[model samples]
Target: MLILKIFVFVTSAIYACIAKNIILIVADDLDVVLDGMTPLSSTRKYIGEQGVTFKNAFAAVPICCPNRGSILTGRYQHNHKIFNNSLEGGCYSQTWRAGYEKNTFATILKNRMNYNTFYAGKYLNQISITISWHQY
Candidate 1:
């Protein structure tokens, strides 16, 4: 009876329609000002009233590559080991090793949770966000 119930639950979950798919959107160079110096007053109101605000959000590091990598990987920069910008002009990537797999959220989420992931930003760290995914 227990085994049957477990099987039923698992099967139901597998076939259950996704009510609302979760979308984690992180925008780099967004100049997110949750405090004061924000020019996006209208956006602030929208995000303030309708959004799930996180006041104590702190990046692992100030640097983009390492921090974005860390956010994706769920691992610290030390763990993934991307320390500095490989690029020079701060426009595009200049890394010697650029085959994805730096330290990012999409890679970890896709690899672990098997969820459909999408990234749109400056992707010149060590990974690209062009990944294919489906529930079928």
Candidate 2:
């Protein structure tokens, strides 16, 4: 099935690569002891010399789909409002998803900032996750 892609317009009226490139990798069910208690905390001890970290970083929910929705949107799951793939029975299911379920941080950042966004991991209700495509 073809996923409907929404491109957010640049809020500044001009697309310029001014901000630092933030590469956030979200691995599900990852052992906290191994990677990090938070997204970039434990890992930061090693990379701290190179960048910043957040220990108190937490999500609205522990679930992958919603938690990711929070991280991407920088808002709670209720704000983004996408609970899971089960929404509308499924993203590409027989039923259609409401406008709310589709809103996300990545979508908004890309829309408002005109960011060339790329989501390379398994996401809740995502239409695609093929490695070859993500890599490209």
Candidate 3:
């Protein structure tokens, strides 16, 4: 039993050491086929070359706010309830914060994997409203 416990602890430690790091970059109005990645050489070198690059991901919605909601929550616009860019459409609204924001990928990473998640870009259309890091 002691040997089995030691083996388990060693295996868990090794797995934690080699755990993959995840970085998600979402750019609006940039198409890869139109030389969008040309100016981001450092990003290409560090993140693209060193990590997995997804080649075939499509937005669940055509509009920006709904699409961003889908990306954050890993849900369809119907599920996330952000249909457009206005607060009435659920963009940064109290409804979104109370109901959907807690279920985002950032929350999952921070809560489940113990990842130190960071967000450094535009989120929704009306993100000028006060928002704290812990909100999402």
Candidate 4:
């Protein structure tokens, strides 16, 4: 089972690199039990069965905003400086509008790699509301 899982993960990564398109889904603060239940059942079935599962993956920052910042900028919260989910200072608006969005992996993919990126669901918590995702 472990070997099969590794094979699947490696294969999916190779295919993604070859295709130059990647879709990443991050569910914040959800219970692990959801993997065995309804709604996400199909996602588990398809993606798990076909793609890869990083069962032991770790988050850079456990909180929603900072972690999402890590994902967007590929930098840790210290560098991105979005310490928490607060809409106030040192948070989403300040961090993003301060120009962290320009050099993200997503922008590189969209501009250089010719990949169409789509971000769905909650973004940096409340700061998501203030910015236009289209510009990213």
lDDT of 3: 0.78
lDDT of each: 0.56, 0.53, 0.78, 0.71
State the lDDT of candidate 3 residue by residue for 1-136, as single tens digits.
9999999889868877988887677777656888888888987898789976778877799898899889888899889889889999888888889878887887777776656666776888777332324333
The residue pairs that clash in candidate 3, if any, are: none
Q: What is the lDDT of candidate 2?
A: 0.53
Give the Å error, residue 38, model 4: 5.8
Model 4 C-alpha lDDT per residue in residues 39-93, reported as the tens digit of each score: 5777778876798776687999988888888888889888987888787635667
Candidate achieving higher lDDT, 2 or 4: 4
In the range 1-136, model 1's lDDT, one tens digit per residue, is 9999999888758755553566765655545555442665776688766886665777897887777656655767676566766654221243323433532455555665555665554554544534433331
If scored against the real structure, what TM-score would every candidate get? 0.56, 0.51, 0.69, 0.68
Specify the highest-TM-score model's number. Answer: 3
- For TM-score, candidate 1 versus 3, the one ahead is 3
Q: What residue pairs are clashing in model 4?
A: none
Compute the lDDT of residue 47 as modeled in candidate 3.
77
RMSD (Cα, Å) for all candidates, in order, is 5.9, 9.2, 4.8, 11.1
lDDT of 2 by residue, 12-128 (tens): 333364565657777665444675346756655665546654456655777776675566546666666556656552333322234433455555556655566676546555555
Q: Model 1 residue 56 lDDT? A: 73
| Runs with alpha carbons beyond 4 Å of true place in candidate 3 | 1-15, 32-57, 128-136
- Which stretches in model 1 have alpha-carbon errors above 4 Å? 1-20, 28-37, 87-105, 108-114, 125-129, 132-136
